[model samples]
Target: MEVRKLHPLFAAELIGADVSDPQNRELIDTVEDAMREYAVLCIRGQGHINDQQQLAFARAFGPLELPPGNNAPGVKSRIAPGLYSASNLDANGEIVALESRSAKIAKGNELFHADSSFNDMPSKWSILRGVIIPPERGDTQFIDMRAVYEALPQAMKDRIADLKAEHSYAHSRRKAGADADDNLPMFKYMRAVQPMVKQSPSGRPTLFVGAHAERVIGMDEEEGTALIEELLAFAEQPQFIYSHKWQPGDIVIWDNRCTLHRGTEFDYLRYKRDMRRANVNESGEERCAIPAEALTQHYQQLSKAEAAN
Candidate 1:
């Protein structure tokens, strides 16, 4: 398999690999090394990949679908449980489950923060394949956090080096048009603490910023909001961003631990962009519920009042 860089830091397209039945141990190592070098890898000619084949291929890098607390149907938390599945619509004509027990416990792609960061046990990697691409508009846009960090002005870089942010699903889901059930604030208490910017495990400098980042650890609410927005503007440059026009049977993997990604909006009302998502858990990572102490006084009091009611 030949590895071709798709961007300065964000993506690389792998050609000449039969991803459907990837058995060559050497090829797997090469892909893993490439993934380490580049946060995202796009393998184009994945015509023969089934769910099991895809899962095995993804396992060469690290663990597969096995999230400690976050589990999904037809997927088990094993080294290679064939976690690779379609993230789009299901065969019976249903939306790729936005509301459910597993997903509620396991945060879906609602925020910009990395995947599985809330559950003390975060995931290692996420491999999503584009099984059925739309005719005209099923493009996934990826931003390079590594590039974002490299391009940061020295002043800003120094400011965020050791900073942390509050990540929550309730806050971000509400922003993304979910969170309708006010009584059941399942996401209100789901939050995570992660560094704002750090050197990736792969030796790449990446800014771990995302929509779920509620605020900087000590900054005022408004100031925190402004800071994240500013970073968003900086990282989302057309020069640093890559807009991949997905094709059917395109297998793509991303390192959620360090990168922040967003699925671009399309004409959901007119078009169907059915695909499946599969994530591999990273072990020994600790996750916790949002602390009551960290909450604003108003929301803190509300929790008390609700109990009395």
Candidate 2:
């Protein structure tokens, strides 16, 4: 199988391999490397994969996360809702126009963000498949945090170099006029304080801002929040985005470790959507202060790997 780079910053298309091919180590590594370098991947031709097959494919990257309690049918503890479920029917499993608010919430995720940014232990990766997609309605979007980091002004970069942010899922959910806290498990009050601008452990630059970034460390609450909102806007420029229009046989794998993303809200009232997702973990990822200089090196390694086979 071969991988095609979609952008110099992030995103790729895996066109020459099958994911459910018995868990080959090299292929898994190749996929992981692609995700590390590109952050997001769209793979076509997979109409035959079922839940078990989907879950199996996702497990290749890591473990699955439990679904949040507010999820629809087929929701599990670690699985993210599929990209197409935005307009799917729950009753009799008919899957028509998306009816649930939870489903609509999925549609509004087009913004860049780390998965579960609201949680202290956010998920590390996500695998989503388009089980049913409208001819033109349900495209998934992605952005390159690493690229955003690279583009920051030196003064701004240095200003945020040692800063950290508070990420809270409940906070964002509440602002959406929804109750997210009741669904997520409660933990110690302490939240994730990851660097506002992180250099991935692999020595890649990664900006960690997202919709869920509630505040910054050591700053007044009001000021920190304003800062968070301002930066999140800057990171989500149209030039930084790649939107994926789906086909039934298409699958997507993304890295949450280095990028933040949101699902776009579409005309779920007019089209049916159903998707399945599986997730992997990086809850145990070691946080470090070292900045990566492998920006170009990482991209080269991934492209080379893609060419090798």
Error of model 1, residue 175, in angstroms: 1.9
Prediction-by-prediction clash tally: 15, 23
Runs in model 2 lying further than 4 Å from the true structure: 70-87, 94-110, 177-191, 283-309
**How far does residue 238 in candidate 2 sit from its true spot (Å)?**
1.9
User: How large is the C-alpha RMSD of every model relative to the true structure?
Assistant: 6.7, 12.6
Residues 73-116, model 2: lDDT tens digits:
23333223322233355645554444455554453354456766
Cα-based lDDT for every prediction: 0.64, 0.66
Worst 10 residues of 2 by lDDT: 286-295
> In terms of TM-score, which candidate is strongest?
2
Candidate 1 lDDT by residue in tens digits, 1-309: 688998765689888878654578777777778878787888876756776776666655555544222332232332233343333444455444545432332233533456655544566677777666667764667777887788899999999889888876655665566532334333444567878876776887779877667678899999988998899788777787777788888877778766766665554445555454567666642222233333344244545766896
Error at 52, model 2, angstroms: 0.7
Q: Per-candidate TM vs. native?
A: 0.77, 0.78
lDDT agreement of model 1 with the native: 0.64
